[model samples]
Structure formats: structure tokens, C-alpha cells
Target: MVWRALRPAFALWIWLAIGLAPLAAQPATEDTEDLLQKAMKAAVARVAPSVVQIETSGGSDILGSGPGMFRKGAGPTTGLVVAADGYVISSAFNFANKPSAIFIAVPGHKERHVAKVVSTDNTRMLTLLKIDAKGLPVPVAAPKKEFRVGQWSMALGRAWAGLDTPPSVTAGIVSALGRIWGKAIQTDAKVSPLNYGGPLVDLQGRVMGVLVPASPRGQDETAGVEWYDSGIGFAIPLEDINAVLPRLKEGQDLKKGLLGIYLKSTDIYSVAPEIASVGIDSAAAKAGIKAGDIIIELNGQAIVRQAQILHILGEKYEGDTVTVKVQRGKEELTFANVRLTGTLSAFIHAYFGVLPVRDDPELGEEIRYVFPKSPAEASGLKPGDRIMKVGLAGSPMQPFSGRDELTQLLDALQPGTELTLEIMRKGAKKPETVKVRLGVMSDEVPEDSLPEPATLKKALAPRKVAPRQGPPIQPGQPGPRPGRPQPGAPRAEEKKEQPKDEKKKAATGLLKRMTPARDHEYWLFVPEDYDPNIAHALLIWLHPAGKNKDKDTEAVLAAWEDLCSENHVIILCPRAESNAGWLGSEVDFVQQVARDVLAEYTIDRQRVIAHGLGIGGQMAYYLAFNARDLVRGAAPIGAALSNQPKDNAANQRLSFFIITGAKDPLAPAIQEGKAKLAEHKFPVVYRELAGSPQYLDAGTLQEMVRWLDSLDRQ
Candidate 1:
């Protein structure tokens, strides 16, 4: 969709067309209308009454009702009674910080009853509420897997304080699924503040996902956790509720199994084997596993790749036992029994009293593993082997079934300690179990923790670029040249141009530029008149997410660099950490690198500028807001100012050159941003890109350099 910012008047027309789009795309068949209308009616009737009206009150009330005043009291925003006898579930954020009392109003019930929070789980984004009510028909859970794309669903809530009606219903559908729900079910339902704790009902009147805040939900961004409607709604899934309910209801703390391994799916998008890159010695390694092992099975279950292994490992508890089977070339072996145990999570639970860490793609797999060097080399602790047990780790020989218990044992031992390992080696005639010391592995070192600032000047540091890695060698195939660099390697032409001192300076300059190890996305511009003998100003550009990170960073930075070179500017466009899109971590990385550059480079700090395209533009605004002290000025091309809380650490220093493309979707956001900047009395320059159709067009550079050049720190 080619979109540009439109004025309020133009926005009305745009929305009018959007509102009329469904009517225009109506099905041609009469049966379609009948089925849809019937389904809507029946689904509404079955689930509507069950969807209670949630009203939250917090803090002491004033003498009279007023804005920001607690009319009743302080508590979670709202909740839905999924079970009878007032077993209510609500957003954890709503109930954070010990809400005084929560209020619940069922449909047809005139009186709102007081409820007390039973327990809260931050990882699940859910809180259990107990109320003094009876016979509440807990709605049936809908099948998450059955939720198809474009399937109709409804948001039920007493929106706008029930001023709208008896639970206003807005219709949307399963727009998309498999969202990062953070241990909860994530669905795209049409919900709002009114639907905060409401149920998302499918055609069968079953709860598919729970209604909660969508992205950019922080109040500083929007009121009511951003819009739950507008097709930007999320729901806690029924399946997730099922798993968590057992723990929540029983009051038993939930602790997920930790393997301390980092795994990247070799599957790409299919059933390809996973590659293990980093494995923590405390767990699988202590049990005799190693990096580069292609795990094939768990507990005799024929697991295809890493994700399956993660799924299996995630289910077991701290003391559970399971058998594992792994393929070692032509031979297959089984770790007959392995006891699952806890790792860092167990410590966090006991000490910090924090919630469970949400799963990440890398942490979900076995990045780290244990292997016995002496025995493995002698009896062959091949990389592909999966350790099934370490019987000696436990007294009474409590089975060392899997990575869990083995990890606990390893943690008990000091560093550089040795222990007996019972491993199922590949192609071995028998289970060759031997003892070896847990020595340090090279990969465990942080990739970004390169040589320190001083000594790094001598190292031949290559500027790491964001690109795809080549495929792993096929099974039973030897890797080409495996790690031996040819003698007398030819230097690149760029390298040859520099003198020895200049080369050292280049290396020193390179040392100052460190990128985030995971998902490093950015643009690199070798200036038009760049000299290998002299260092150039590396202006890093960060964009907000709309498409691929690497591509967007490249396009925007290339445009900016081209414009800047006319005025002599060197640009390094860093992509966000997320390959899928912009994430909070990416923003931090850009800012951190900026600090690093300032410490190492002699460039004019007043000339340090951060710019973005669309969301990138938003990020620039955010960076200026966050670290205005570090930033000279910002150029947000297609994005505008953020409405996120000014209380945010970022907003204190926000200064910007707000740019708006004539056809940008966020023109309104931009205009509103400009308005907010004015409200805050923050100094800002506005650049409205007239007739510019999109974000990555010629105007992007024109606006970037124009703004950057205009800045004067003094």
C-alpha cells in the first residue's frame, strides 16, 4: 500500500474508504451472506452474556468525580471471569503493584462486585482474580490451531465505560497468528480498552485468545495500552491458559526447563536440522554434548530439528526424567534415561524473585553443550552426539537423564572441574562413558567483547557486515578447507592503499566500531572521496520496522550518504537487531554504538546525527528524545514524533527535524508529533516532503542532509 500522511480532512476520506472496503469486497453468493450473518448472530448470543463487563478502580477517591481521580479505588483495569465462582483472569499490567481491589460486572448484572487478585504471572501477562460470585459459566476455549486466516472473531466489551452500550461488539478476524505472545496466546482481535479483559470468541463461541494491549502499548505511546481494536488487538491463547492454569490455580510456581543452550534453526522455514553454536557447560556439555551436534531425537521421540527439541525440553520440569535418542552418522544411540534439572532460572526465582524469562529464538535451542575431551577423543565424543546421562553426578546414582540434573551438578562444581560423563557417542560399539574436566571452550566468549580499546589497534579487525551465512556441509561430507587460511593471503586493494601507520589507525578506528552480535543490520557507505589513510565520520542510520531490516537500512543510508557526500559525510547504516523488523534492542544498540564512537573518534560531536525513514524516522525521534544530550539533531523522514510517555528516559533530550512524505501513513502521527514537540517546547525543524510518494525515494536524502547540515550545537 502506497501511503502518505494526509491532513485531518484527507484522513476522513481515507477512513471512509477503509470503512467501505469490506462492503465493496462482499461475496457474490447469497449463501455467504446467510452463513456469515447467522454465524455472527449465533456466536454473539452464545458468548456475549458470558463476556463480563470489566471495570477497574484504584486509589482513594476525591470528594467529587474528576479526571485522573480514583472514583472508587485502585486496581487492575479489568478482568473476565473464565471460570465459575468468580475465577477471573486479567492483564498482569493492569494488576501490577498490588491493586487495591478490582471490579467485575457481568452482563445483565447491575451491581459490580469487588474481587481480589489471586496471583500474577508476568511471563504469561495474566493475573488470576477471585471474586465472591457464583455460577459464572467459564467460556469454552477455542482451538488455537484451528483459528484460520481471515476467520471471523468478535471483541466484546463495555467500551468507553459502557457509554457505548450493553457490551459493544466490534468484528475483525484472525488477521494473523503465531505472534510472539510471550508465553501467552497472541491473536489479532478487534479489542480496545473496553475489551481489555474480554474474551475473543470464534464462530463456535469459544475463547481463542484473550484481549490485551497490542504493540506500542506503553501509555506514553497511547491511552489504554494503545488500540485493542483497529485490527491491532492481541489475545492470550486458550492453549497457553491451559498450561498456565494448572500452575496458577494450584499456586505452584512455574519454572521452565533450562538447557542453557543457544540454537538457531537450520530449518530456515522447513524441517531442516538445527545448528548448535553456543552451549553452556553447566548442562548438556557436562552430560557430554558439544557444539555442531545435529540433535535428531528426544526421549525416543523422532525430533526433526531444534525447535522440536526446544518444545520437548520446555515441557519437562526440574526433576523430570526422559530418554533421548540421537543419530551419530550410520549408527543411532539412546540415552536410556536423563533427569531434567534447573539452571539460571532456578536461581533467579529464589534470589531476584523475578518472573520467568520469556523465550527467545536463540535461547530456545541448545547453543551450548558438554563433552568429555579425553574420553570423547578416545572413545569419540563426536559433535553430533547427544548426552543421555551422567550417572555419577548424583548420589544413590539418581539418574542423570538429561541436561537439567547434569547442569545442576556442573553448577555445583568450580570452574575447570572434572566429572564422569556417560555419553552415547556416534558409531560407537558400546556406550563409551568416561571422565573429563570441564574446560573452557572458545565460543563461549562474547563476540562483541573483542580486544580491549588499546591492544585492538594492532589486530586486523574486519568490520562485521550483516549478511546470511552459507549452508552447513551435508551429513557425511567433509567441510571445504575446514579453518586453514592459505599462506600469503592477498590483501584487498583498499588495504594496500594505506601506509603502516594509517593501517594501524584504520584498525584502531575499526576497534571503536562494534556492532551487536546477533542480527546486526545496517548500511555501510564508503565515502566518494574516502581515503584509506584517513578515517571518515560513520553516521549510523537506524530505521523503524516496516520490511526487512538489512534492506531498509541499506536503502535509507545509501540515500543519506549520497546526499551527505555532496557535503562530505561518511555514513554507516546499522540495521536493527530484528531481521523481521525494528525491536527495542535494536534501538539500544544504535545508541550504544553512538556512545562508543564518541569515546574513540575525534569527529564533531555536534555533527553526530541519527536519522530514519519511516519507523526509522520514529526511532530517530525516539533517540533524540532518549539521548538528546548525545544527539545534535534528528531527521525523521517518513516517521513523526512518538506519543509515548515523556517520562520516558529518551524524551528528555528529544530534538528533531521532523520529515513527512506527502503520502506517508503516519502523516497524522508526524503532525501530532510536531504538535507534541511544540507542546513540550522542544526545538524542532519540520520538513514536509512535498509530492514524495514513499519513504525510500529521493526526498529522503534531501531531507536528511538538509536537516543534519542545519544543526549548530552552540
Candidate 2:
């Protein structure tokens, strides 16, 4: 018996060597190719019986409709039989539209059986369905630990019609393992909507994984579908699905577990896992975990960076219990059996209603501006009042050192919490104590013109003046002017002589033709007196389709020059590849430009915002929702939402400012979008113009600037 097994293994080794031999060393005969082809066919035939054709009709759109939106095809899809008693598993993306009726065509059955969804795994983007049938064929699952890169892999799908037809097959090799936070395996096989829910089998005819689309940046069902057939595909391991098959069959919709803690830095690779804020009533809070605690170990695994914790938590389901060890100050504590929850209470920002002076070095924080009916106003706080100390009711006061400390303290508290503040007026010798209750931050813009923000006293040089080259254009009304270069035309360069006594300064004021990479160019506007010492806010502008020419840049500068200088904000405008519109592929380019600017300039991370008009606004929504770590706020004018808004998270904080005209055609959609965001507990500031207009008027633009100025509000 031993000799018989050894003979079969020796023969397989010879076949592999013949098939993989290089031509230079020795050319393989026709027999090698024929043997490989037959092996792939045999693998397909083994798994084809377990694959079933799935069809649906009359479903509404789950992902919102807009430019570059993902639309599901009308053809049949595929699924795999997971059990012998009529249980099947498929991708959640297949049922994202929530079809009214589902039908499954099983093998060797002449009739289609009606099917119903059993449960869904939102964390893995997989769905389980059941039909009234018995004795179905189930494919064998390959051991995950035995998978290796460069091994032969075949993708099988039953999207073709007729039960008699064989499943379509594509052959390739395993490209990677443990991708997408350890939830997916990477393969080079052709994976798309046709084979999304099918089986990926090995050379031995054992199922390795189930094909699906997934992305690290987004958690939506259709997040990674845009990369279909692009030599990059993802599949969830069959062994993992089999491990959770029992829970799925119990009709429990599994969701990602939440600890409700925000990290101090978004750079998970380099930054230590330091908690910045803990959500109220969350798993962390219930376990007596507080902010400033550094996670040291999770589930008996040593944790060094935030990514490790994410990987451990990514595979955990709601209601799962995990043990956590944290270092609080000089003490190391461990919490046992902390149960994770599916959702946390939405965090509402508590408002103190005062803007502090920028870069003030005084012992206390000085107030710059106080709103008319705010908590500070009610507490008799005025401009120039220095807050010496602060604390909760009946608690010892702590020294108020800087604006950051105060901001963090208030962020961890609730809206109705009462606080006591010790204030020192400008001309007062002693400090006075005042008590006030915190309130919710308002979403409406201030009605009156606000006072300018106060800055630290510094002596500066006089501003430099440049001669005008063309006729003056009115603000907010930049029309085609004479002697100006047309859209997409090369502009003539002009060399000017500089004065001998003039000091060299950084490039400022309308720097054009900035090419960060090949086929990518943008325009930047830096204030005339750009100061590296002062941290400035960065604003990325996305223009409407066919309006990103030279004139558009001029219009933006003419309308926002004064605002940019006054608010200390840097403006960046990235151009799309074509005038047709912005593509989903350009999101990375835009994000790269912003990152380059951040690295080059002293940009405040808390004030980074994305503002766009019309179609460009849709891209803004995409970037803000997908890149939550980079974008702090989104301002979309004359555009509706393109995708469904995700639930608010304690770690990823995002706010919105939506603008639309009262009579504009997209006004209703914008309103509906605002309502959806509000339902998810996102802070939204909405404004409606008096009449229909394609772009923002001068007054409305100033209001937006004011909103940007207050984005760092505590």
C-alpha cells in the first residue's frame, strides 16, 4: 500500500516538472499542455454541481444614483450550495438592491425553486439564502493554511442559462493571502459580477474561496466593484465561511463589532494605539476604559500599532467578548470578557461658543469671538476674556493650558453637562468663577457679519504689489475676457525683472500648471503674505464638468482672494483628466495632491475640507465618505449625494455643509440627501438660496468661508 501511494506522488512530480520547465532548458511536448487543460477541466467538473444560477427582478437601488455610480447588470448571477439541506451562500452585493423575488436553479433539477434570504454577514459582505430542497451537493473546502501563492486556481460560475449548460471557468494563480484586514484572499483570475458569488477551486477540485469584491477604504457592499476585471480580485476564504455557517443558519445578521474609541493619529502603521476619546455607553466605556489609555494587548495578542487591533477586531462579530489590556498612565490594567456591541450612541458635539485666539502663548486661552446667544454669552463671557481654569461641577479645577486641552476635554463630555470656568478679564486683577451648561452645536450659519479672528502680535513687512495685466473683472461674475487664453490652450510665459532690494519669498498668488505627476496638473492660490509660522486651513476645490478651464480658476481666485487672506486658508484646485466629467478612478489623484500639500505646508489637520460644485460635489461626497481619515468636512454646492452615508463612528468624525438653490432642479434630492445624513446623526449645515443659480453667489460664498473658519469649534 505504501509503494502504491509513493508511485502516484512520484508520477505527479514528473508531470509538474514537465509542465513548468522553461523553453531554454527544455521545451515541453503537446502532452504537457493537454494534461494541464484536462486537469483544469476536471477541477471545474468537480465543483460545478455545487454551483447554482441566481436570478432576481424588481429591486430598488441601494446605492444612490449619480455620475460614476455602480449599476447592477440584468443577467443571472451565481451562488454556492453550503449545505445538503438547501442552504446557499453568495455575496451581499448580489442582493444589495433587495429584489422582490429570488429564484435559484439547482443542478439536476428541471424547475427553479423560490428562495429567501436567511441572514447576512455585513462584516464580510456575504449573504446566506435558503430554498425548500433536500440532498444538495456541497463542495469540499480546501484548508486555508495549505494555500500558497503561485498555486493553480480556477474560478467557476453558473451565470449561463439552462441547467444542462456547464459552468464557465477561468484559470489563474493565487496572488496573495490575508488581504483586506485578513478577511479576503487575492487572486489574478477574472472575477466580476458574473463570477462574484461563485467558487474558486484548486487543482485538486477543492473550493478555496468564494469570489467577492472588497476594499479597505470603504465598507459598502459595492465598494470595490469598480475594480472588477482589472487584474485585481478578492475572495473570502471558504474555511472562514464554513466556520460561521452555523451562526448564519440561525438567522442572525452579523455586524462588525465596535469598541467606540478614536485614536490620536490616523497613521496606523507608525502611531501607537493611544485613545483620544471614548464614546458614551460604548463597550470601552462600559468596561471602564477612559481616554489616554494605550492599548497593549488584545485577546492575548500583543498590540503595538492601531492596525493590529483593527485586524483582530475585523473578524469579530457583534456580541463577541474580547479581553483587553491597556496602560493607563503608569499602571497596566486588564479588562476581562468585554462584550462588543454593534452600534454606539451618536456623538453630538458640545458647544462652548467661543473662538480662541490663534497661536496665543499666554498662560490662559484668550477668547477671540463670542456668539450672540451662546453658552459663553449667557455666562457673561466677552471678547478678550482669558479662561484660567475649568472643571466639572463640584470637582477640582484643572489649569487650562492651551486650546487643544480644552477641546479634548469638551469632546469627551455630553451636551447637558454643567461646567465651571475661572476667567480673568483684560483689566481685572483677580479671576472670577462662572458656571454654565453646555449646549448642542448649531447647524445654521451666523446671521450677522462676524468679527475677524485675533492672532498673536507680530511685526511683519509691507505687502508687495504686482501690476495688473488685464481688465478688471467683477467678483463672482468672471466672464470670458479679452486677450485671455481660452480653455485647454497653452498660455504664453512672461518673464519680469525684479528689484535689486526685493527679498526672495516662496511662490504665492495664482501658481499655475503644477504637475505633481504625469497627466495630472492643478492650480494653487497662496495668500500674498503666506507665513509658515502660522498654521493655515487647506481647501480643495472640485469644479463642475467642462468648467475646469483657466477662466474657472480666475473666477475662483477673484471671488475668494479676500476670503483666503482673511481666513488664512490655502486653496487647491485639481483638474479632471477630461471635460466629460470626473471619474471614480481620479479619487486617488485628488487625495495624493492634498497629501503633498499637507507635507509641504503647515496645514491644520482638523480643518482640512473638500468643497465642490455640481458634478464635482459628488466626488467630494465620495472622497469624504471613503477617505474618512483625511477629510474632516465636506462642502457640496448644487450637488446631491452619490452613495449611501455610513453610520457615524467615534474614530472617524465627519461633518457636512450642503448648499442648493430653492428653485433648482436638484433641490429636492439635496434635501433628501440632507435628511439621510441627519438620520445617521451626522452634523449637517444646509443652506437654500433665494433663487435658482448654478453656483454660489458672493454672499453665500462668504457664509461658507465663515463655516470653514469655525470647523475647529469645540
Candidate 3:
């Protein structure tokens, strides 16, 4: 058996030997390690003069808020002299701490010169500083067209040594390109705070890119700062920066361009870029792009997925005109010269003031309620009309047929635009087409004539208003009610009232505490008398910025407890990440908290409200606008709108209850924001305080509670 196994092994070895014999006899190539080492030294010598050291002193340890949030590092940073006219460029992060004094040290100089900030490119995370002297060494940029992966890259910095000392260098290869959505190039070089603001040079010492902290996840001064010393690093190509140098020198802050369309699908991999909601005043709307239009190509690049669009246009700035080709239904449409904008005119939702009855899931929505003075009423649409199709008589866009689709369509068109609606009245044999001009959504709350929500009535029908408590009636004590007998001593009482079902406690009275884990750690207050069976209103309290968060939580609970107990309200207060305060990114955290409460407790979707005061109030407005699908009511006290909100027809159902103090510093802006919102036709209930509000009186708190309860009204 051993001999048989050895025979098979020997035969396999002989076959391998035959296969490798010809290759093993070939000659080897010469070594290039020493040659490459000498070349690298020469390259560093060629580029060292352009690099400089920047030192700062006497500033706060931490810088700006959110993405710009910075922690002062221990060492000086590196910068590249970009021009001979005394203009030097460095990472924006080097100055993020806002040092009281800035000084620059050039190569081979024993003394330093005070440098002044010239202009900053916020988008690229670069800053230009000016000195008194000119004739600085300016590095030559390698042509970007010649860029390729696997090419040698050397990252140089002046972090460790004096101006006369050789600069520190890390050598690696270009790992990728068009990173950070085409804004950066990728390399495997060791990059960190030590080398940031320096240059990534080629084999011949030609500058390829300016190194800055970056990551695929974000674009910010400190976004990639966390990855210090990691092999992965980013450098903005000098070729791209040179193209934008003129604009940067003009001191214009670059803003990301906006298309203003919310897509229908969240699937990142397979879903094409399809418009679900178009802001009425957005570039997309201005270019006549409609819902259901699939973006086929952006600029000149073919886009197969939503991410492809982001990759192509993510780095584009406002005022950039992009030609787009879209597939609308079966037709291919081209829209050329769609100029993007960083800002848009305020969007106001056009309204028809009609509520659809949601009785059958399979049928088109039927009209259940129509406001007296709305476009629906003016067009002679009745309460029982079933909407079938919606659009203009002759238009390129197809007629929208679904209830939700119709709502999006109406919101896309501005007020006073004519729309043709195909509707079938109760007794009609066929659908009739009628012309209805869109109407502005009013800021006023719906009148009392609107129908009561059947769900609310159904939930409240079984519960009896528990009588107020008092000292237990003694045998001879008079009854609490005007004529009722005492509980234990009354002979006329037909029977002792059945014991109250205290077991089924409702959220009422004092607020109960809860804690949930999220990006924004939050405190929750559920009224003690809250009913688990019936849906309750949830109020997310955002307070003005200040220290003493524990006190803020207490105050929010104290102000809303009685109203909460009486009306079944739960309050959630999410604290800012740090004392530096609120960030636009925190909006996601707030939404997570709301969804958590909704999931863990019984909460009313239509009665979900965002209420805040001071900075908290501004955040409340921010939360409501960012989480439009979750919030039904926004009640802010003495805060202006955070930014112009995107207009949508489905969210037209949103309502606002704003209280402003005429004497308040932000009062005018608040009123203007309210006016802009009202123009979009959002139902707004405006309340004016004689002056600015120092406190919310008991009466006002009660009124706000009533507004939240009424949020469910048709």
C-alpha cells in the first residue's frame, strides 16, 4: 500500500517539474529600489521651499458647531504658498479654532511674519492667507488628465522641524480617483493633522493635489479629522482648485447646488433617480420637471441609479447650469440649461381644501369634506365626488390618477394656476371634467364647521369623565355635587358607583420619566393618567440654547404637565450634543426619538406636535420642516423659521400655531416667516403677544393644548 501511494505522488511531482522547467530557467530583472530612493529625495528637495509652517495662539480650545466642530491640536500645521503675490493657502481647519494671533514661518527664514486671512473656500476646506512679502515659491501642478491609480504620491509637511530642516514626507501610491463624489482623490499615504494643508506631489515633484481632512461620509472641516494616521487619505486635485481660484479669491462661500426633488425610493442600489416631490420654487420645478420623471442623464454622464446622480452633481455649485435628459413615462425628454441655485424662493403649497374619505383601500379617494371658500367649493366639487384624473387639458405631463399623486401634482403647481379635475359625483353616470384654479393655503385653522374625527370619538365614547377628588364624604357630610348623595352615607344612592378602573391608568397628571438611546440623548415625560388604549398627543420640546439642561427638562415638564394630564400629552425634550448647541444634523436624531416614542407608546400621528421656545422654538421649526411626515402641528414661541422650507402638497395638511412678541428682537423675522408660510397656504394660527413673551401664561398653555387636540380635525 505504501509503494502504491508513493507511485501516485511521484507521478504528480514529475508533471509539476515539467510544467515549471521552462519558466525557472528565465533570467531575472535588475533592482530599482536604490534608483527610486534617490529620485524621492530629489523630489522632496524640489518641493520643500513652497511648504510653510503656520502657528496660532490664544483661542478657544473648541471651534465652530457641528461639522466645523474642532478640538485644538497640540502642534502647528502646514500650508502651501500658492502664489508669488503673498497669497498662501492652508486647510480651513488650521484656523477653525479662531486663534487670536496667526504667524507664518517660511523656509530658510529665522523670523516670522504676521499673516492676515484673505479669502476662504468653505466647500474645499481651504483658506488663503496674505503676508507682506511676495516672490514666494509657487509649486507647479501636474496635469490632472495624466492621473492614474498606482502612480507614486508623496505627502510633505512642515509639522515637526524648523524652516531650515528638511520637510517630513510619506510616500505611497494613488489608490483611487473621483472620491467624495468627485471632489477628492484617494491615496494610501499616511495623512493626518501633521500633513493636512500640504501638497501631494508626483515623482517629478509636480503638485497633484492639496491635502485636507475628508471622508466619504461627509464634507466638513473636521469630517475626516478622526481618521488621523490612517492609511486612507484624501487630497483635492490642484487642477480642480486652480479652476476655482478666482472665485475663492473673491471671498464667495461656495454652497451645494439644489435640485429640490425628494425621490420616491430609498433603495440605494437599484432605484433610478425618480422624482416623488418637487419643491414648487425649486430648480427642478422651474425647469418643468414633474413627479415620476426618471433622471436618465445628468450633465453629460449617464445615470442608472440615484447614487449615480449624486456622484455626477454632488460637487456642483449654485449658478452652474446642467443639461439633463429624463425619461417621462414612455417619452425621452431633454431639459437643457437648468440653472441650479443654493437658495430658492419660498415655496407655498397650493390648496383645493378638500379632504378625501379613506373608506376603501381599493378605490380612488372620494371627497369627504370641502372648505366653504376653497377651490374645491368654487369649482362646484361636492362632498361625494370621486376624483379620477388630474391635469391640464393639453399638457406634456400625463394626468395623475392616484389620490397621493394628485396631491403631489397640486402642490407642484402654484396658486392661481388652472387645473382640470375629472371627478364623478354621487349620481353622475360618468366622470365630468371641471376647471379649478389652485387656491393659496390659508394660515387660519379650519373653522369649527369641519367634521369631527370619527376615530377620536370612538376612542373617547366609553370613558366617563372621572369626578374630581375631595375628602371622602363622611356619614353626615354634604355631597360634592349640588344634589348627589354621599358615597357611604346616602340612602337615596341607587347603588355604590362601580369602582373606577384605576388599573387602566391613563397618561395624565404629573409627567413620568423615560430614557431612550439615540444620537441625541433625550428625556421623556409621559402624563401619569395616560391611557394605553387611546392614542395620545406627543410634544417634542426644543428650548433656547443655555446651560443647565437638567433645569430645562424640568421646566418643560412643569409647563405642560397639567395640560398634558387633561389632554393626554407626552413631552420629549432632546438635549443638544454639547454646550456649543444645536446643529442641523441633529434633526435626524430628533426624528429617531419621535419614532421611538411612537413605537414604544400609543401616540396620535395627526396630533404629533413640535413645540419650543427661544432656540428651542427655532429647533422645533427645524424639526417640523425636516420631519414633515411625522409632525402634524408646529407651535413655536418667538422664533423665526430656520430656513425656507420645501413646499409639498401632501404635507399641505401641516398646520402651524405661532406666538410672536411684537417687542421681541426676532419678531419681525418671525412675522415675515409666518407670512411666507401663509403664502404657501399652510394653515397658520397666529397669536400676538403684547410684547415679547417672558413666560407662557397658564391660559396660553391651555390654548396651545387645545390647538394640538384640534390638529386632528378634518
| Total clashing pairs for each candidate | 52, 0, 17
lDDT of 2 by residue, 1-714 (tens): 222222222222121111233222114445555566567667777888899999998897545544456678888999999999999999998998889999999989989999999999998899999999999999999999999887777777777645676687766678898888888888877788887899988978999999888888778678788788787888899999999999999999999899878766566897678776677898998998877678999999999999999888888889999999998756798999999999877777777788777544344578877877898899999988988777777665556435554665565566888888889999999999998788886565666666655456211211112222232111111112234322111112211223456585457888876564478888888899877545578899998889878997788778889888887889989999889668777888888888777765556566789888888889889888867777878999888986668766544567899999888898999999999999777789998997877678888888887777776665
Q: Can you give the TM-score per candidate against the true fold?
A: 0.47, 0.86, 0.62
Best-to-worst TM-score order: 2, 3, 1
Report the C-alpha lDDT of model 1 over 609-705, residue by residue, as the tens digit.
Answer: 7766655666665566555446646766776554432421111123466667766666776787777665544456666766654564454445445
**Cα shift from native, residue 616, model 2 (Å):** 1.1
Best by lDDT: 2
lDDT of 1 at 133: 82
Model 1: worst 10 consecutive residues (lDDT sum):
349-358
Candidate 3, run of 10 with poorest lDDT: 11-20
Better of 2 and 3 by TM-score: 2
RMSD of each candidate relative to the true structure: 18.0, 11.1, 16.5
Task: Flag regions of model 2 displaced more than 4 Å.
Answer: 1-34, 61-63, 66-68, 361-363, 457-504, 649-653
Per-residue CA lDDT of model 3 for 524-562, tens digit only, reads 888776555455778888766673278767876777777
lDDT of 2 at 602: 55
